[model samples]
Structures are given as structure tokens and as C-alpha cells.
Target: MTPSRRAVLAAGATAMAAPALAADPVSLARDERHWARVAALFDSPPPGVIQLENGQFGAMTRATRAAYEQKLARVNRETTLYTRRGALQDVQAVRAKAAAFLGVDVDEIAFTRGGTESMLVLIGGYSRLKPGNAVLYADLDYDSMQVGMESLARLRGVRVVRFALPEPATRQRLIDAYEQALKANPDVRMMLLTHLSHRTGLIPPVKEITALAKARGVDVLLDCGHALGQTEFSLRDMGVEFAGLNLHKWIGSPLGVGLVYIRRDRIRDIEISILAEPSDAIDARVHTGTVSYASVLTVADAFDAHAAIGPAAKARRLQFLRDRWAETLRDHPRIQVLTPPDPSLHAGITSFRITGQTSLGQALELKKTLFERHGIFTVERPGAAKGACIRVSPSFVNTVDHMDALVAALKEIAA
Candidate 1:
């Protein structure tokens, strides 16, 4: 019985240097040797294609994947016997860890199937809207979330106010836009503020906008699908009472895990929408029946791998990878970098368009060309009001060379 190389690496015994967590994090971001050690925690990409489309969901690390598989097997073998015996408590324990990791109280959070489920629960469950009262969301928000907000127009008799966020957005401009929209729609009682836009990797000024909304007697529902692991911030500091988050994106968990957060005082504002399934706690917001126990169980391991890299260090490293290619391509004559130079507005997730390609067809062709001709994998995201673009989200597993390869490919394609 010999251990595999993945097993050895999974145990954290490897040639890669352990993360120098004590070092200045900004500098550590560029310390290739240090990052090389951190990168060793996951297996490399396949032989031909380089994966740059991590924004859809995070691929589990080796250790986390192993734990997920083991738990999955246990669930299959034990069946109802396994889940019936303390699984609720077990799931709640993992929820507590996630809450602590995100700097929130354990009671304030509950696990859902994925970010979309969380969004739907929070939006679909909001109890404060009245007939003619309005809710707001931006064009940059996730498609499913946008639809959920639209549904409230019928479900709760609230008007769904949709706005397009300013492009080449600045912190001040973003705040101003929300302020103007609120001022114009005085009847608006709630707003959906996307903490991070997957389409353009736009991080809005959430706290500032939330404050603005508060001044106008508006409540905000925060969407943190892409913000959790890679972006550095506290939920409290963002000043949102309701939020939907994902574990599979930046948190590096197994698929099918997500979270819902409501400030304790505001819990009653989001009613338990699950018919006949009553709960008074935050869990009241979710009733995902018969979820993947393995995905939820493996959360502790994913949280560990994220913590070992350390939030600050991980944020710095991901931003570093983002800037490596974005900075290089921003000035190119034929390429348009959608994410601005502002560090606060983006993480590792970014999107760009070939100068003349704004239609979905053009973006799709460019994505296909990048994949089939260039061997660089990315996804076409088409929600930005301006037009469609290709998204490049680099995980910590990606190397500087991967970014460089993308830069080279874009240069060739654009030429």
C-alpha cells in the first residue's frame, strides 16, 4: 500500500515552499518561489489546455476533493442511517466554520445549494416589499439573480427597477449613479447591490452605496458570489442586512455549496418561503431538500485550504495574477480591457473584448478561437449593457506563464 504523489502533496509534504504568511503580503504576492509552494497544493492543468475560466465555479483542491469523495462514499454506504444520525448538527457545525471565516456570527448564516439558490431564497423570500414598492438591480448583476428580482414584480407586487452601471466606472461615479437612481425612484424600498460583477469583474462601492440607500430608507441585498474568497472584506463592514454567497467560486469548495446571510434583527424580514417547513432561525431562509451531503461535509476542508493560503495573501496573489495580464493588455491598440486599472474594482476575475467585437457572436467566436486555436480556455459573458466580452478568471493554481500565454494569444489574435 503505497501513497500516491497527490496524497503526499495533499498532506502538505512537498518540495513547494509553505506559504511565507508572515512576510509582507503585497510583496509575497510576487514571490514566485513562495507562490510556487502555495500553488503545489493543487494538481496542474491538463497537458494541452490552460484553464482561465474559474469564475463559473472553483475547482476543488486535491485535499478537499479527496475529502469530498470519501464523504460521498460514506453517505452512499450509510444511506438514510448516516444522514439521520446528527447530519443536521454536522452541517450546522460546518456552517459555523464558514461564518467565522467570513467574520460573521454562526447564527447569521445557513448553507444553500449554490449562490443562485441563496439569491433566489433571499430575493424570493424578502418580506418587506408592498404593492407599488420597488426593488432595484443593475445590468451587471448575475442573470439568475436579475430574473429573481424581476419575479418579485409579480410575486410580491413590487416594481423591479433595473439600471445599467456606468462603464469605466470609478468609485465616486458608482456611488453617484446609485444615489441618482434612488433619488429618482423615491418609492424604491429595496435594492439588489451586486458586491462584485462577474461580467466585468466590477467591484462596486458597496458600503458607500448601502449608506446612500439607507439614507433614502432603502435596504440592500448583497450578492457576494465572486467576492467571498478572493476579495478581502467583512460582511458587517459592507453594511448589508441580506446577502447571498457561494462556496464554489472563490472559496474553493466542492460544487453544490452556497450560503445565505441575514442580519439577526432582519431575519424576520425574509420570511421562510418553504411551505409547511417552518423555522425561526436563519435556516428559515433555506429549505433545500436532500442536498449533496458530501458537498456540504467537505466545506471544512475547503475552508482549511483557503485559510492556509491566508485571506490577505490569497487576495493579493489573485489580484497579482489579474494585473499581470490586464496591465499588459490594457494599452494594446486592438484589445479593450473591461476592468479598469483601479485595484478596488477587480480581483482575479476580469473580462476584455477584442476592440471591434461587442456582439455575442463575435465574443463566442473569439472564445472558440482562443480555445481551439490558442489552447487557452475562457468563457463568454454577455450581460454587460455595453456588449459581450470574454472572462478570464485565474485561480491560484494558474501560473504567471498562463497569464503570459493569454497575453501572447490575444496579441496574435488581435493582430
Candidate 2:
């Protein structure tokens, strides 16, 4: 089979420049040409600014950006004539591509506006839990899930039990905590698991967790917004009841695309979020009307770029950057690294609580300081009441030198 245009270009770029990447523990600065192409993906990145926030949103790859632009222009040109029939076909093509990437039946995958929408639809569709019933979640799961659960708890008269894992965790420890939580709340009909925790950068053992939940007669809904392209997993293997994730975070797609996977058997169990006549498809959580067609269609290129990097290579590259920065900052007196040192516990995202600072205050200061003094840009833990923390995520396009410069800047700031 002939190589894809993206594959050829990525391979060529990887070969041409690798010094900063090769010499350092983390490397995104391989070749100037590749870096330039990668950098161009961000619409308004400051000159010399180093972005370590891929967990929030990733800049689209050149392929993805170009594809979006081309399709967008075409859509604009045909605005008057762009029929729902034609757009639906395009969405179907994108759906098939997304399904292939996720290793599921195309009929099993439904598109949503983003992670928030996906979760809301799931929460609403799951009418099985009543007021006396309970829905279990973790303290570290994305705040959006917490909000969704809260709203549903109020509407359905269900109890929402928010569980917390012990800090500086391990796989076994996390499992034990979850088991205990579930045991205490035996009436729980639904459980939410995060493949990766946004707060602590801890990735739970999804398969094991889901298996345990299933054995106990509980349905699992995985908040995979931080997990999808950042880490690789097959839905079939994980054995979760449903999984929903955003494409914008790690997949390098446009902002609005998200995916919700409804297990084949459970599709009939939940009601559709939007009123729609019965459909033949097994997956039907996609209930919103008039979605951004271009945004959803743009999801394919994110998969393509991810595939071009190859899953293993991308995993290694993300770990490299994360470990590089974490290992570097471990010795600093003021930094309390929250992400596990164990590679299994983290991927591209790392978070730490710094000494003697409030999260929001520190965030504001750092945001201003980095931009004004060092040309770096990052978000601080604005809501961390326990302490101030900074979260960093580096993609394959970020070189080791970027990590080094970031560390140097941090050291200077600390001093």
C-alpha cells in the first residue's frame, strides 16, 4: 500500500531534524521545517511562546488545519445550496473514519458538539437512576462531569456521591479506593471514571475498573476527554458501558468535535437526549440539531495525524516530555509534583502544587510574568484551594529544548 501524504511528510520531517529531541530527554525541536509547520497550526501563538497546555487544547496539525480551511471555504461558497442531505453524507464519512480510529462499529459511534454535550446527553439518556438511586464519581474527574452529575441528581432526585482517591497514588491504591466507594454505595446505578484525571494527571485502570463495575451491576460512563488521542485504548477491550471524549484536546482536530460510544447492547436502554424518531442505529446519543458540520467533519484529520505518528511513537514522545519536566522539577523545594512518577500514571499531562501560593493568585502572577518576562504561556491552577499548581502538557511537536527553556524559566522565577 502506498504511504499517505501525511505519513511521508511526518517521516521525512522526523528524519531531517532531531538534535534538540535527540540530545535531550524530551524533544519536539527536531528540524526547523517540521517545527515551523507544527507551529503554524496555532492561530495566534505568541512569538517565542512555549505552550505546555495540550491538555486544554492542542493546536491542529497542518493537515487538520488545511483540511478544515478548505472544507470551510467550500461550505461557505455553497451556503445557499448546502443541503442537509449532502452534509449528512459528509458527517457519515467522518463518522466512519472516527469509528475506524476508535476500533468500533460505525453505528456504535455518535457525534456530539464536545465533551460537555456528550456527558449531558449521556446523563439525560440514563433515566434508569431515580432519586433514591445514586451516581458515583471521583473528586478528580473533570469539573464538567461533576456539574452534569449535580444537575441530574437534582432533577432525578438521586444522590451524587463524590469520591476522592488518596494523593500520590498507585494503580492498586486507586482500585482499592474505588472498590470501597462502590461497596459503600451498593445502590449506585451509574459510575463515572476518568481515563486520565485532569487535576492530578492520574490515569485510572479503565479495564479493571469497568470490569469491577460491571460485575457489581453498575454501568460505567468514561469521561475520556483527556484520554482519547493522548493515550491509546480500544473501547472493546475496556469493557465500559459508554465512553465520550473531545477531539480538540489531544487529537489536534477543530474545537467542536466529540465522540460518544454506546455499547451495542445498552443502546436501547437509554433515551435519546433530543427528541428524534426511532432510528435503526445502535448509537443514538447524538441528539443536538444543526451541529457544526465542518467542526465534526474535521475530526478525521486528527485521527490521521495521530496515526501518522503511530500510537507507540506518540505515546513515547508524550511520556518523554512529561517525564522530562517532572523529573527536572522534582528536586525543587517549592514544587510538590502531583503527577505520579510512574509512567503508567501519566501521559502528556502533569500537575504540581507549588509551595506558599494560592492557585488563582499564582496563576495570575505566572500568566503575567511568563508572558512579560520569558515569552512563555501557561495556565495555573485557578481553583486549587489546597495550593497553587501548574499543569503542563507537551505534544510530539514540542521539543526537549522547549522543556529545558521552560524549566530554566521556572527556576528563574522560583529564585
Candidate 3:
């Protein structure tokens, strides 16, 4: 075999030989030494920082980080081999693992750089939209997806209907608003639903909404960017035609890796906007040129990490922290909780606004002050509400003490 072909085969063998099992937690339970090792994988305190802004980016764990480091090092040694065919096998393995976790066939999932790219692919791929037809989204949708819709509207000369969720919405009211929008714009051929809104931390009843849209002949694209690792659900259960999820967030994978799901039958009909390399294959829409193989390969580690920890246990622990802290701040007169207090309506995220505050600058200052003075790090925003407020997202690694520290920071600032 040529040296290049031999190297390619070797890398493929290594990836296939990589263990799929979860890391041993006995080390975590038995020794304080392991805690520091695990903690080092995350952004360390004092310089790197605490990451309550996981809604923005959740860095990888020690296992996934090490896996990427090793893979990248190996790729550096065999660049030609990796660039040719090894990269393909690595990405396929990750995609297959992600599909298994998502409860879909391997062919149903597509690898994308991240959620934004995935959303662009979905919105731009549809051939149905024209001047009179509309794309339906809402106030709660992520800004990136919203921008994609607006840009498409501008470029395609179609109308983009952005709706609102009634303040302090009841479950039925939330569903009704979407239904009403669909009814009003009967010409709406597409709907972009955020399974979990980044700002409000609200999770819509996606299955119900998707079913309603399908019955009306509207194609639905669901964004699970904030929902995937944070909540428990099956993509098959939601029945949406297209969905995108960021693996880095709740799954704790390496950055720049995401999964896009296209319903099995619809793959051929959607044209990818991304220019792909020439290939005789199925679902060419996903084969965008020269993706990062190291990041893609770590997605499997993210899945393993998630499963090993136990989803139900992780969910309960995260939600517990949010609820415990949110309840304490809920009664503050100056605070207006944008997220519903009901646990069923949300997950790890809880966002609110300080009643009198204004500007993202003020919010940012508050976050910095809390970190500097009280040792709590969080995200602040001049959000789509009364005013600026801090947002907190705790992970499975966080403890009740973390919530207590946050509460203390709020009390100090509020006082």
C-alpha cells in the first residue's frame, strides 16, 4: 500500500478501536485528586472563569477534551492521510453515535459545524418560499435563526411573520399563539420553532405544534440548541421534518460540532446551500467541505459522557439547582422572572430582569461585579423584556452551594 493509504487505514483502525464506554466515576468518588483533574478540563477559575453562560458555550469534559487532543496530535503526524479518507470515517462514526442517541437512523443525521450553520442549511434549502408565502417564527426564537429567516425574506422577497408569546403564558395559550399565527398566515409554508428559547428558557410543546403544522401542510424545522442535553426527548417522538442540535452544550462535546436531522424521506428534496465536494452518495447536502475531524470525533465521547452520568439523574440535579435558586429570587420586588417558575415548562436555565435596570452594559457590569465581589459568574442581558437581568445555567457538576453563592451575590447586589 502507498504510505498515504497505509496511514489512512491506521487512523481509521484507531478510531474504530476507540472505546465507546463511559469513563469510570469511581476515581471521582474515591479521591480529591480526580476532582481537580476533571475540573481542569473546564475553564478553571481566576482566569479562564466559571461558565454559567453555557447557553453561549459549554466547553468539553476531560475525556472528550483528551480525545480531541490525541486525535489532533495524530492527525498532525499523518496530515495527508487524515485529509483524504480518515476524516470521513471519523465523522461517520460520530454521526452514527449521535443518531443512536437521537433514536434515528444514521442516514437521518447530518454533521454541521454548529447550530447556526444547521439553521442556515434548513432555511436556505427550502424551495417553496416565494414573495407571498411567509416563514413563521416567534419572539422566543434564538437570534441567529431569526436573522436567517429575516435575511431569507429579504433575499427571496417573502414575508417573515414574527409572533409573540403572551406574557406569563399558560400552556394552552402558548400553543394557541402558534396555531393562531399559522391560521392567520395560511400561506405560511415553513415554521422555525425553538424547542427551548434562549432568553425566556421556555420549552414549547414541540410535538403538539409540529403535528398541528404538518396537518396544515407546513414544514417545521426545530432547533434543539438549548434543549438537547438539557432535556430528555426522542427526535422520532417529535416528528419534525428537520431539527438541529448543538452537541457542545448539554452534551459537553468539543466545540464546533453539531447534528442536523432530516426526516428520512425528505433528505433528497432539500437542497443544501453549502457547496459540497463532488461525490456519488446519498444526502450530499451534509457533506460540506473540509470539516474539523477532531471536533467531530469527540461527539461520540459527549454522548458517552451523557449516558454514563444517567440522563434522569443529571436532569434532576440541574433542575434542582435552578429551582432552588430561582425560588429564592422570585419574590424580590425588583426582579421579574421571565421564565416560568413551573419546572415542567423549562430545564436548567432561569432568566429574569431586574425591574428597574436598563442596558446590556448594566447587566454586564452586574455580572462582573458578582464575579469580582461575590465569586459568582453569570450572563447578563438587555433582553426582550422589562429590562436587564442575569441568567444562570447550572450543569451536573454544579452543587447546591453554587446556587447559594449565586443567591448571596443577588442579595448583595439587590441590597
Candidate 4:
């Protein structure tokens, strides 16, 4: 059947009887049969090239996409009636679900368009910086987030301090750099921490870094857009007071669904972006005008599907895929794995550069060569001190055979 018709049939089936949850966690870990069943939940990508760029945007599962379409249809039919009568309650329900998923209080969560929007709201509205106060962000932070911080510095009249993460980073070395920066810039009032670097998939020691910042009287705005659904953790686990997350990335929610969290007591620290009724609630600080009600409402379905597979199981599968390819090419004479092999520091996303090819042109050309010559798709990320490198990010849908193909391509191209 065609994909549209299949989606309609799947929607009807789901409405009649809830689809079963993913296989049990233990079984999912040890049994390929169970993993294959979970993989079947997603629609296969286009036939020609292997898609290993899920970190940029993960396509929704068959169930999630169908549910989103059904919701959109319902909203279009009901029109303003649904918005007037039922939208607020529906949104509140999803907000509560999101809070529970993050182990945060319901009042602390606010939905935004996506990760970039969430970050912009927090960085632009934070109220504590002054003329001489400083803010810090590292090279590994997302490009949009780095821009937001720069805007914040201009608006708040605070100096912006930029730093580079250790080229070959370890958990301790990462913490030490942050601590040294904080100590050196005693006037720094806020720091932006990317829980997982998008450039090279570096998982920093967030809890440790948060603690270090807190001890020095600095507040940390965590950009967890890539961390939330990919790895297992909670708000309490990270000990953070403010954060921005993307459900569309790892949660596999429909595009345009993201969240911002402000601890109940810390709500006063962020200025309200939209002119609305005076309140201290987290939602008051976020002003995403006329968002897609359908996308926000369907987030509950994404949550349901994510929970079914379980975060622990998902983490294992992503790491396994990363390791499968990394280990295969580790000994290649011209290949250098940018992400550290330590499980604590890396996940599915990994980058590598050809020994002598480090320019942006080289990286882009390599990406094109992989797609045209080897039927593989990847992306180039800039700002690495060493040079630009191609990034590969695989999801649960990718298979061992896919990684084997990537390994084979690298072996021939890098040789």
C-alpha cells in the first residue's frame, strides 16, 4: 500500500486499540529479534543512500507521523472551536507528561517551537547580567545558541567570553577547563553548557560542571537539545535550574515541538518575553505566538512511543551503532575518530577527518563523494580546532549492515 494509505490504516488501528509497547528492556538488549521489531516501528528512509544524519533531525516513527496527521485533521475540522474549548486542557496534559518525563515539577515546563527558540528565549531574557558582568560559551555549543549568547551580551551590556574545549577531552579535563574559566572570570554571571556537543558528540560532565558553576555563584543554562531523548537522564539527575530541550530530535516528536524548563524558585531570574498577565510561572517567560496546536498536542504520542522502547535500551542501541563503525575504522592510517572512545563521553554522533583534508571545502567535498560514490549521506561540522570533519549520526533504525557499509566506504576513500 502507498504510504499515505498505510498511515490512514495505521491511524484507524491505533484509535481502535492502542498499539503494543516496545519489547521488554532485557529482551531488547540481548535479542536482535526484539531490536528488529523496534526498528520496524519507523518507516524506512529513501532507498538509494543510507541516512546516518539523524542527529540533525530524526524522522518520526510510523505511529508518530500518523497520529500527528490525525490530530492536524481534527484541528482543521474543529477550527477555532477546538482552540476555544479544548486546546488549553490538552496542552496542560502534555505539559504534565513532559514534566514527569524530565522528573521536574509541572509548573516548570513551557513548550516552544524548537530547540533554537527555547534557547533564544532563555538567553535573551535572562535578567541578571550587568555592564561589567560576563557570560561564557564554548566552541562546542550549537551555532544558533552561540549567536543567542552574543545577542544577550549586547543587550545586557555584558562581555562575552569564548573558549575552546580541550582538543582531546576527558571527563576531568572538561570540568577543569570550566572551573578555570569560572575562576579566571570571577565576574561571569552565567554560562551556557551543551550537555552533548553537536559538533562531535561529546557528552560533558554536566552534573559536575553544574556543581562547579553553582559553587562559584554562576547559573548554567543547559542546552540539552541533543541529550534529552538520546541518553537517559532527568532534571534532578543533572541538578540544573534552567534548560532547553528538543522533543523533535531524540523524542521523535513532530517537527516544531520543543520545551523549556525553569525551576519554580528560579522563575524570577528570567524576564518575560511576551506582554501578558503578570505571573511567575515558566510559561509566562515563553512567547511563541500562534504555534501549531496539532504539533504540540501530538507530543503525547511521541512520549508514549519513546517510553515504550525505554531510554536505557535506546542508549545501548545508539552507542552500539557508533562503536560498530568507530571500532572498524579506528586503525585506518588516515582516519581519526573525533569523539573519544570512552562510553561516558560519546553516543551515536561521531566525526572524523581525513589526515590531510581539514578545510571546509575538503569536508564538503568528502560529504559529496560519500553520497555520490558510496551511497552514504553525512554532514560537515566546522569550528573544530583541528579542522572541519564530517559528522555521522545514526538512530535505532540503522542496522549493523548499514554500519558495515559505512566502514567499507571509509576504508576505500581514506586509503
Candidate 5:
């Protein structure tokens, strides 16, 4: 009998893992030696360009990329046979692996194309809203999600409430704002919560805010696209029943892999978006037609690489990198670090705008200058109260030296 394509791909993936297994396990402490070994697992960015824009899309590990390529080749060769017969078990296995990683039941997880799709499905298919009912979202939520909520309100004839979080926000202030909003809008049926803000890298007090929303009989949808792999926390800890996560962001999987978690009991509250093949299974909630099978298959490989380094270690490394650069620029006169100095409120991502650069164009110009003059790569994020800013996010693959270089560049730019 001819060996199945999936078997071939799995064997190749196993071969790709040998190098990772041979390396010393990453340490939780800030040991440069251990981290340098881990950094070798990823493809380096172009020479002389320090990449601080990992929040846009994470770079895939060498092992996972090889595995993805093998899977893609197999799928291309086998075509329908791979999709119809060979892919089912592989996909289910990946789902089981993801469920285990997330600390949730298999039935509660549904694979989607990416975070945007998962969020749009949840926000659009939510069954609890009606005319005169209200939905709430903050200014810091992802632009795509915010647009989805607005459309949802318009289509369902529901009131949409938008709020702006304070710039130098504290935990107490954030909680108070949410509590006051819920109290003011007694008709609010649902609220969208971003576990981590992409603009300023603000880590909101999710568990506390979710509890407040629950007591007011409001359902919360958590956008954990940036939070999951960057930080070590499980859905159970978040205390929210619905969430959308991106495997590609911090998990280092291939692009276009994400999942939605619906609590087993609360699954019924979300209407199924795909009507053709109606079923009560969690996957029925979102319809994704003919997605890249190879991308989904590689998630298990990414998880394996992530596990070898340890999620706790990865979180610490990211936090350490953020602080390495942030600490140096905190006192600079011309720099305004938008992310709070509070350690609990931030992680790998942080943003800074030059004192006089406030608009989008100014922010873009600053990013360009950093790249052309200093050989550093950063991104401009708009929507902050003061103005647009440059977001700096370091991944596990980044080194302490890279961050040091970033600090030097920032200092030069400030001068």
C-alpha cells in the first residue's frame, strides 16, 4: 500500500524537530547563552535591520516552516485524496492539541482562518442582541473588530456604545470606567474586550472586567490575538466564556491559523454562521471554505517548538526584552512611552512617539528615519489620544543585543 501523504508529512515534521530537541531547553532567567540558542531556531531578518514590529505578524520557527512546506507539498500532490480522507484525522489531532494547550475541551474549540475571521463570526453571529439592546467596545479594540460591532449594531438595530480608555491608565481607572459604563447602559447585552491592546501594548485587567460584565448580565468576547502566546495564561484564568485567538501571532505558527473558544454551555448563545450544514458542533459557528490545510497542519509543529522553549520562559523573555529598551527611553526628554510603566499592564509590546511627532504622517516619518538612518524596523500605530506612535514588539527570537541596538537608535533619534 502506498504511504499516505499525511504520514509522509508527519515523518518530515519529525525530522525537522531533531535540531530543536538537540538544543538546550530555554531558561526562565535572563541567560543570554540559553536565549541565543533559542534565537537560532528562527530565520533572521535582513542584515542591519533590527525588527521591532513582530506584533504585526510573528516570524515562524525554522522547524515549523519546514513542516508547513512539507505539508503543502503533500497536499499539492494528493489533492482531493488528501483533503477527503487523509486530512480529517490530522486536522482533528491539531484541534485536540490546541484544546490541550488552551486548557479547554475539544468540543469548545473551533479552528478559523485567523483572528479577524474568528472575531467577526462571534460578533456577527451573537444571538443575544435585539432592537434597543446595546453593545459596547473600546477605542483600543482592533479596528476590524470595532467595524464588525458597528455593522452588527446597524444591522440589528441595536445601540452601539463606544468608550475611550485613559492614556496613562491604571488598573483601578480601567475597572472603574467599565463598571460605570455597564451601570450607565443597563441595556447593554454584550461587550468586546481586548485582552491586550495592539496600539499601546496595554494589558487590560481582563478577569476583573469580565467578572464585572458578568454580574451585569453582559456577555464578553475577548480578543486574545496578541495575548495568548506572548503571555502565559489560560482561558479558565481569563474567566470569559467566549474568545478568539491567533496561533500565528505568538505561537509562531504559519500565517492564517486561529481558533475560537466557546464555553460548552454558552455555545448555544452564538448562532451558527454557516447555515448549509447545520450542526451544533462548535465548528459550525464559523464557516471557512477551503482554507490552507498546510497552515492548519503546522500548528502542532509550532506548539511542539513552543513547548520545548516553555511558555513561561517565552513570556519572561519577551517581558525582559520589552523592559530592556523601555527602561532606557523612559527618562528621555523627547520620547513619550505610551504604554504604562506598570509591569502588570504590559508585555512584549510597547509604543513610543517622539515628543513633537503626533499625526500619522509624523509617526510614519519617524519610522522611516529609524530604518534609513539607524537600520531599525518599526511600525506606526495610529489611534492613541495624543497621536499616532511607533509600536515596538520583540519576539522570543530577538536577542538582548538587538534590543540594545534599538536603545542606541532611540537615543540617537532623540538627540
Candidate 6:
């Protein structure tokens, strides 16, 4: 065989079935052999690039892509014949499945284009705030969410209070910070809490902070865009009445799929906007007009892949990949790891900055160097309260080797 063909064959051989499952996902996480097999389930990325910037969205597995294409073809073939007739029923079926996956009431969830759309729906329609009331958010909250809250200030005549969570924060310290903020801003009747900070990949203590907010009578509109599939948690347990979630990120679905969730009792708090059909169903809260039928329907297939590995395993596997590189480089003098070692405070996503290079331009340059010089893809996340950072998110498709490559590249660059 030709040399190139032999190399391709060798690579394909690693895609063999994962060995019998480990007793638990934590143990399974360190088993590179199992992850390599799992990685093979996803169609490969381009040959040369190591895709570590997975926070933006997830890659489709072969099975998911096939299912998506088939759904697409079916939707096209039937056109509005299916959409105008049986589509809502089909969507309801999918909604039931999504609700079960989230452990939420089916009536509480509504589909939207993606997490951003879901956020917009919740922020724009929040009906509880009145003039002179204050809405609080942190620096680590997602950018679009911050903007939404700012717009809410104008629309509702509420005061906007933005604070920065303590860098290098711990579970107790985080809660303390929120408690202090809530006490300091007495008029704060609403707040935004991001389950996972997209900028620094810091998973805050949502439950405890939500408790603090509740004691102060602050209604929380949570931005859970990156948390749903990235971490294993019961959304209800978080005690937030409102949230936005995405299927396209950690869930590995095709893009343009996400949902808005309001606890059943709180549904009345979000005013039914004109975009909706003026119905009481949660689905009527946000209508973007003609969503991609294929993207919505194929969530069933995505959930298949998600459940095959299971949420705990997927989360552990992702954190495993992250830990490998982050732990390795944490001690480097010139490198600063943003996510703390607190296992509860971090998961799949993490961010870091080269010492003293904390500006957006510097972060972009570092990202460019990693991409162009070493063929390792990473993304620069601006708006970190302390500094700009390069965010790294790994999917199940990534293995220890990809992380090792990133470590080696960063070490060389820092040197």
C-alpha cells in the first residue's frame, strides 16, 4: 500500500469499539483507549487542525449528521404539507423528549433558534421589573446576556448594577461575593447568573447563589447556554425559575436548536410578546418565524448519541481532557490558568492567559500564534473581568494527545 494510504488505515483502526465500560465515568475518563474509540464516532475534523475551541458549538457525529440530513430531506420533500399539518405534533414529540432529558415539565419548555434566542425571549419579556428597581449581573455573565440586562434597564426603567466575581474564587467565596452584592444593592429585584462563564469557563455555585438571591427576593434569569450537556445536574435543583439552554454546544446537535425554560409556576411572569401566538403554552413565548425543521427534529438523534455515552461520562470525559493540559501547564511561570482546581467549580471548558498579556489584542495574537504556527485551533474570549483570556473547550472527540499538543505548543510559545 502507498505510505499515505497506510497512515489513513492506521488512523481508522483506532476507531474500534470502546472496551467494556469502566465501573464509573471518573475511571473511564482517564482511559484514553475508550475515548479514542468514542472520538471515532464523530466524523473527523480537518486533518491538520486540532479543534480546542469547542465552546462555540459542537461537531456532529456521523450518526447525527446522517439523521439531520434525512430529516432535512423529509422536511423539504413534505414542505409545509408536513409543517402546516403534522409538524407541530412532531415538534411536540421532540419537546416531550427534551423535557424528559432536562427533567422538566413539558409545558415549561419552548423551542428557539438557539441559546441566544432563548436568552432574548426571556430578557425581552420579563414582566416583573418596574421603574427604579435594579437588575444585577456579574462581569463573568455572557456578553449578550449583559446587553440584554442593559436593554432591560432602559425598557423597564430598572437600574443596572454590574459587578465582577472575585478572580481565583472558591465555592464559599463566590457565595459570599453574591451575598455582599445583594446586600449592597437592595433595590436589585432581578439578576442574571451564568451557570458556566463562557469567558473563563468558571462554573459558579449556582444553587447557593440562587438561594442568596431568593432570600433577598431577587428573581434570577439564568443563562445556562453552556451548562446543560457540559455538566450533569438537575436544572430544577439549581432553583432558578428561568433559564436558556442549547442543544448545539455540548449536546452535539446540529446548530439552530435550543430552548427557553421557565418553572411551571413562573410562566406567567414572562409576558406573551407579539412574536408569539398569544397562547399560554410556553412554546408561544418566542417565535422566530420558520425555524429549521431538520435542526429541531434531529434533536432526538442527538439525544441518542448523548445518552449512549451518558451525561456523567460525557462531562467527566470532557473535564478529563481539560485537566490533562491545564494541570500540566498550571505551574508554568508565564502561564496563568483561569479556572481553579476546585472540581466543583469547573468542567469541560477552561481558559488561560500568558502572564502580562491580558489585553484583547494580546489574547488574539496568542490565539493566532497557536492556530497558525502550530495548527492547534483555540479562541480568544474577551470581557473577562480580570483580563482577556483564551478559552479552551474540548468535546468527547478530543483525546489526551490533542491536549498534549496544546500543552507543548503553549510551552514553546511561552518560552
- Evaluation by lDDT, superior candidate among 3 and 5: 5
lDDT winner between 3 and 4, please give it: 4
Error of 2 at 310 (Å): 2.2
Clashing pairs in 4: none
RMSD of each: 2.0, 4.5, 6.2, 3.1, 3.8, 4.4
Each candidate structure's TM-score, on Cα atoms with residue i matched to residue i, is 0.95, 0.87, 0.85, 0.93, 0.92, 0.94
**Cα lDDT listed for each candidate:** 0.86, 0.74, 0.72, 0.85, 0.85, 0.86
lDDT of 5 by residue, 129-183 (tens): 9899999999888999999999976788999999888877899989998999899
Q: How do the residues 1-415 of candidate 1 rate in per-residue lDDT, one tens digit apiece? A: 1247447646672232245457777998888877777766776878899999988888777877877888888899999898999777788789889888878899999889888999888888888889989989899999999999999988988888898999878889999889989988999998888888889899988889999899899989999999999889988987878999999988888988999999999998888866536767887678877889889989998887777777788888889999999999889999989888899888888899987789999999999999999899999999888899999999877889999999999999999
lDDT of 2 by residue, 229-306 (tens): 777788888887687778888887898878888877778767854667776464455677677777777787667666
Model 6 C-alpha lDDT per residue in residues 38-149, reported as the tens digit of each score: 7877778889999998899998766677778778888999998999999888988999999999999899998888899898888888899989899999999998989999
| lDDT (10s digit) by residue, model 3, range 175-218 | 89889999999988888998887876888788998999999999
Better of 2 and 3 by lDDT: 2
The 10-residue segment of model 5 with minimum total lDDT is: 16-25
Q: Report the lDDT tens digits of candidate 4 across residue range 1-415.
A: 3567756645533432222235454345545655677777788788987999998777777877877888898899999999989999998999899988888989988999988888887898798888999999998899999998888666888999988888678889999999999998999999999988899899999999999999999999999999988888778877999898999999999999899988898999999876666788787898877879999998998887777666777777788889889977877889988888888898788889888898999999999999999889999999877789899998877888888999999989987
Q: Candidate 3 clashing pairs?
A: none
Model number with the top TM-score? 1
TM-score: model 3 vs. ground truth: 0.85
Pairs of residues clashing in candidate 5: none
